[model samples]
Target: MTKKIEVLGSGCARCKQTTKVMEMAVKELGIDAVVEKVEDINEIVNRGVMATPAVAINGKIVFSGKIPSLEEAKALLSKS
Candidate 1:
Protein backbone atom coordinates (compact mmCIF):
# COMPACT_ATOMS: atom_id res chain seq x y z
CA MET A 1 0.00 0.00 0.00
CA THR A 2 1.09 3.53 -0.67
CA LYS A 3 1.96 5.28 2.56
CA LYS A 4 0.56 8.69 3.29
CA ILE A 5 3.42 10.73 4.67
CA GLU A 6 2.92 14.33 5.79
CA VAL A 7 5.46 16.89 6.92
CA LEU A 8 3.80 19.54 9.05
CA GLY A 9 5.25 22.91 9.91
CA SER A 10 5.19 26.64 9.29
CA GLY A 11 7.18 26.43 6.05
CA CYS A 12 10.41 27.27 7.83
CA ALA A 13 13.88 26.13 6.89
CA ARG A 14 13.69 23.13 9.18
CA CYS A 15 10.34 22.10 7.77
CA LYS A 16 11.71 22.36 4.25
CA GLN A 17 14.73 20.32 5.22
CA THR A 18 12.55 17.70 6.83
CA THR A 19 10.49 17.47 3.69
CA LYS A 20 13.61 16.99 1.61
CA VAL A 21 14.94 14.32 3.91
CA MET A 22 11.65 12.48 3.79
CA GLU A 23 11.54 12.61 0.00
CA MET A 24 15.10 11.38 -0.23
CA ALA A 25 14.36 8.53 2.13
CA VAL A 26 11.37 7.55 0.08
CA LYS A 27 13.39 7.57 -3.13
CA GLU A 28 16.23 5.63 -1.56
CA LEU A 29 13.90 3.04 -0.13
CA GLY A 30 11.86 2.90 -3.35
CA ILE A 31 8.73 2.70 -1.28
CA ASP A 32 5.30 3.24 -2.74
CA ALA A 33 4.31 6.42 -0.91
CA VAL A 34 3.58 10.10 -1.15
CA VAL A 35 5.37 12.94 0.61
CA GLU A 36 3.37 16.07 1.34
CA LYS A 37 3.84 19.26 3.35
CA VAL A 38 1.15 20.69 5.59
CA GLU A 39 1.55 24.35 6.50
CA ASP A 40 -1.85 25.03 7.98
CA ILE A 41 -1.50 25.76 11.67
CA ASN A 42 -5.09 24.85 12.36
CA GLU A 43 -4.61 21.42 10.97
CA ILE A 44 -1.34 20.99 12.77
CA VAL A 45 -2.89 21.98 16.08
CA ASN A 46 -5.87 19.73 15.51
CA ARG A 47 -3.48 16.85 15.00
CA GLY A 48 -2.12 17.60 18.49
CA VAL A 49 1.32 18.45 17.22
CA MET A 50 2.94 20.91 19.62
CA ALA A 51 6.01 21.32 17.48
CA THR A 52 7.04 22.20 13.98
CA PRO A 53 8.81 19.91 11.52
CA ALA A 54 6.53 17.07 12.46
CA VAL A 55 5.91 13.96 10.42
CA ALA A 56 2.70 12.00 10.19
CA ILE A 57 2.34 8.67 8.47
CA ASN A 58 -1.02 7.12 7.69
CA GLY A 59 -2.73 9.86 9.72
CA LYS A 60 -0.61 9.15 12.79
CA ILE A 61 2.05 11.53 13.97
CA VAL A 62 5.35 9.68 14.18
CA PHE A 63 7.99 12.37 14.57
CA SER A 64 8.04 15.97 15.62
CA GLY A 65 10.05 18.97 16.93
CA LYS A 66 13.06 18.67 14.61
CA ILE A 67 14.30 17.53 11.25
CA PRO A 68 14.95 13.85 11.29
CA SER A 69 18.06 12.34 9.72
CA LEU A 70 17.85 10.23 6.57
CA GLU A 71 18.40 7.05 8.55
CA GLU A 72 15.68 8.03 11.01
CA ALA A 73 13.28 8.79 8.23
CA LYS A 74 14.08 5.49 6.57
CA ALA A 75 13.59 3.61 9.82
CA LEU A 76 10.30 5.33 10.47
CA LEU A 77 9.09 4.48 7.00
CA SER A 78 10.24 0.93 7.29
CA LYS A 79 8.17 0.43 10.41
CA SER A 80 5.11 2.21 9.08
Candidate 2:
Protein backbone atom coordinates (compact mmCIF):
# COMPACT_ATOMS: atom_id res chain seq x y z
CA MET A 1 0.00 0.00 0.00
CA THR A 2 1.09 3.50 -0.79
CA LYS A 3 1.38 5.85 2.18
CA LYS A 4 0.48 9.51 2.10
CA ILE A 5 3.31 11.46 3.67
CA GLU A 6 3.21 15.21 4.21
CA VAL A 7 5.94 17.61 5.27
CA LEU A 8 4.44 20.76 6.74
CA GLY A 9 6.26 24.05 6.71
CA SER A 10 6.41 27.49 5.09
CA GLY A 11 9.11 26.62 2.57
CA CYS A 12 11.87 27.54 4.95
CA ALA A 13 15.32 25.98 4.97
CA ARG A 14 14.39 23.52 7.67
CA CYS A 15 11.26 22.55 5.81
CA LYS A 16 13.24 21.89 2.65
CA GLN A 17 15.74 19.87 4.59
CA THR A 18 12.97 17.83 6.15
CA THR A 19 11.53 17.18 2.74
CA LYS A 20 14.90 16.10 1.45
CA VAL A 21 15.39 13.79 4.37
CA MET A 22 11.99 12.25 3.81
CA GLU A 23 12.77 11.71 0.14
CA MET A 24 16.03 10.01 0.94
CA ALA A 25 14.37 7.80 3.51
CA VAL A 26 11.66 6.78 1.11
CA LYS A 27 14.17 5.98 -1.60
CA GLU A 28 16.31 3.96 0.74
CA LEU A 29 13.39 1.97 2.13
CA GLY A 30 12.03 1.16 -1.33
CA ILE A 31 8.54 1.71 -0.01
CA ASP A 32 5.58 2.96 -2.01
CA ALA A 33 4.80 6.40 -0.66
CA VAL A 34 4.06 9.93 -1.81
CA VAL A 35 5.72 12.80 0.02
CA GLU A 36 4.06 16.20 -0.22
CA LYS A 37 5.01 19.62 1.12
CA VAL A 38 2.35 21.56 3.01
CA GLU A 39 3.21 25.22 2.98
CA ASP A 40 -0.11 26.86 3.72
CA ILE A 41 -0.26 28.38 7.17
CA ASN A 42 -3.95 27.76 7.60
CA GLU A 43 -3.56 24.16 6.58
CA ILE A 44 -0.68 23.64 8.94
CA VAL A 45 -2.61 25.21 11.77
CA ASN A 46 -5.71 23.27 10.95
CA ARG A 47 -3.67 20.14 11.31
CA GLY A 48 -2.83 21.33 14.86
CA VAL A 49 0.87 21.80 14.26
CA MET A 50 2.28 25.05 15.62
CA ALA A 51 5.84 24.27 14.57
CA THR A 52 7.20 24.20 11.07
CA PRO A 53 8.99 21.24 9.51
CA ALA A 54 6.45 18.73 10.70
CA VAL A 55 5.64 15.35 9.19
CA ALA A 56 2.34 13.55 8.84
CA ILE A 57 1.77 10.03 7.70
CA ASN A 58 -1.65 9.19 6.33
CA GLY A 59 -3.11 12.40 7.72
CA LYS A 60 -1.71 11.78 11.19
CA ILE A 61 1.07 13.94 12.49
CA VAL A 62 4.14 11.91 13.41
CA PHE A 63 6.87 14.43 13.92
CA SER A 64 7.11 18.17 14.35
CA GLY A 65 9.38 21.17 15.09
CA LYS A 66 12.64 19.66 13.89
CA ILE A 67 14.20 17.83 11.00
CA PRO A 68 14.33 14.12 11.59
CA SER A 69 17.22 11.88 10.68
CA LEU A 70 17.03 9.44 7.76
CA GLU A 71 16.52 6.50 10.09
CA GLU A 72 13.74 8.32 11.92
CA ALA A 73 11.97 9.14 8.69
CA LYS A 74 12.26 5.55 7.59
CA ALA A 75 10.77 4.37 10.87
CA LEU A 76 7.88 6.80 10.61
CA LEU A 77 7.19 5.68 7.03
CA SER A 78 7.43 2.07 8.01
CA LYS A 79 4.65 2.57 10.57
CA SER A 80 2.31 3.81 7.88
Candidate 3:
Protein backbone atom coordinates (compact mmCIF):
# COMPACT_ATOMS: atom_id res chain seq x y z
CA MET A 1 0.00 0.00 0.00
CA THR A 2 1.08 3.53 -0.65
CA LYS A 3 0.95 6.19 2.00
CA LYS A 4 -0.28 9.69 1.17
CA ILE A 5 2.17 12.20 2.58
CA GLU A 6 1.52 15.90 2.14
CA VAL A 7 3.54 18.96 3.09
CA LEU A 8 1.34 21.99 3.57
CA GLY A 9 2.65 25.53 3.36
CA SER A 10 2.80 28.66 1.25
CA GLY A 11 5.69 27.45 -0.87
CA CYS A 12 8.14 28.74 1.67
CA ALA A 13 11.65 27.43 2.27
CA ARG A 14 10.55 25.65 5.42
CA CYS A 15 7.80 23.90 3.49
CA LYS A 16 10.29 22.70 0.91
CA GLN A 17 12.63 21.52 3.61
CA THR A 18 9.82 19.64 5.31
CA THR A 19 9.01 17.83 2.11
CA LYS A 20 12.68 17.02 1.57
CA VAL A 21 13.04 15.63 5.05
CA MET A 22 9.94 13.54 4.62
CA GLU A 23 11.22 12.15 1.35
CA MET A 24 14.59 11.31 2.85
CA ALA A 25 13.02 9.71 5.88
CA VAL A 26 10.74 7.55 3.79
CA LYS A 27 13.60 6.53 1.54
CA GLU A 28 15.72 5.62 4.52
CA LEU A 29 12.94 3.49 5.95
CA GLY A 30 12.15 1.91 2.58
CA ILE A 31 8.51 2.87 2.91
CA ASP A 32 6.24 3.25 -0.11
CA ALA A 33 4.67 6.70 -0.10
CA VAL A 34 3.08 9.18 -2.45
CA VAL A 35 4.26 12.63 -1.47
CA GLU A 36 2.69 15.93 -2.47
CA LYS A 37 3.20 19.61 -1.74
CA VAL A 38 0.05 21.58 -0.93
CA GLU A 39 0.32 25.32 -1.37
CA ASP A 40 -3.35 26.18 -1.26
CA ILE A 41 -4.03 28.44 1.66
CA ASN A 42 -7.64 27.33 2.06
CA GLU A 43 -6.75 23.69 1.97
CA ILE A 44 -4.11 24.17 4.63
CA VAL A 45 -6.52 25.96 6.91
CA ASN A 46 -9.08 23.19 6.51
CA ARG A 47 -6.68 20.88 8.26
CA GLY A 48 -7.05 23.02 11.41
CA VAL A 49 -3.35 23.64 11.48
CA MET A 50 -2.64 27.18 12.63
CA ALA A 51 0.95 26.98 11.51
CA THR A 52 3.01 26.78 8.39
CA PRO A 53 5.02 23.79 7.21
CA ALA A 54 2.69 21.12 8.42
CA VAL A 55 2.66 17.49 7.43
CA ALA A 56 -0.21 15.13 6.75
CA ILE A 57 -0.19 11.41 6.28
CA ASN A 58 -3.22 9.58 4.94
CA GLY A 59 -5.31 12.74 5.15
CA LYS A 60 -4.63 13.07 8.86
CA ILE A 61 -2.56 15.81 10.40
CA VAL A 62 0.68 14.43 11.77
CA PHE A 63 2.96 17.36 12.36
CA SER A 64 2.34 21.07 12.41
CA GLY A 65 3.99 24.42 13.15
CA LYS A 66 7.55 23.10 12.86
CA ILE A 67 9.80 20.61 11.16
CA PRO A 68 9.41 17.12 12.49
CA SER A 69 12.19 14.70 13.30
CA LEU A 70 12.80 11.62 11.16
CA GLU A 71 11.76 9.34 14.00
CA GLU A 72 8.51 11.23 14.45
CA ALA A 73 7.87 11.22 10.73
CA LYS A 74 8.57 7.51 10.61
CA ALA A 75 5.95 6.93 13.26
CA LEU A 76 3.34 8.87 11.27
CA LEU A 77 4.28 7.14 8.03
CA SER A 78 4.08 3.74 9.68
CA LYS A 79 0.45 4.41 10.49
CA SER A 80 -0.29 4.82 6.83
In order of listing, the candidates' clash counts read 0, 0, 0
Candidate 3 per-residue C-alpha lDDT over 1-80 given as tens digits, one digit per residue, 9 for 90 to 100: 88889999999988988998899889988988888999999999888879989998889887899887778778777766
Which candidate should be chosen as best, given TM-score against the real structure?
1
Candidate 2 or 1, higher lDDT: 1
Model 1 residue 67 CA deviation (Å) reads: 0.4
Task: Give per-model CA RMSD.
Answer: 0.4, 0.7, 1.2
* Candidate 2 residue-wise lDDT, 1-80, digit = tens: 78888999999999999999999999999989899999999999999998889999999999999999999998988877
Off by over 4 Å in 2: none
Quote each prediction's TM-score.
Answer: 0.98, 0.96, 0.90
* lDDT of the candidates, in the order given: 0.97, 0.94, 0.88
Judge candidate 1 at residue 52 and give its lDDT. 90
In angstroms, the error of model 1 at 80 is 0.3
- For model 1, name the residue pairs that clash: none
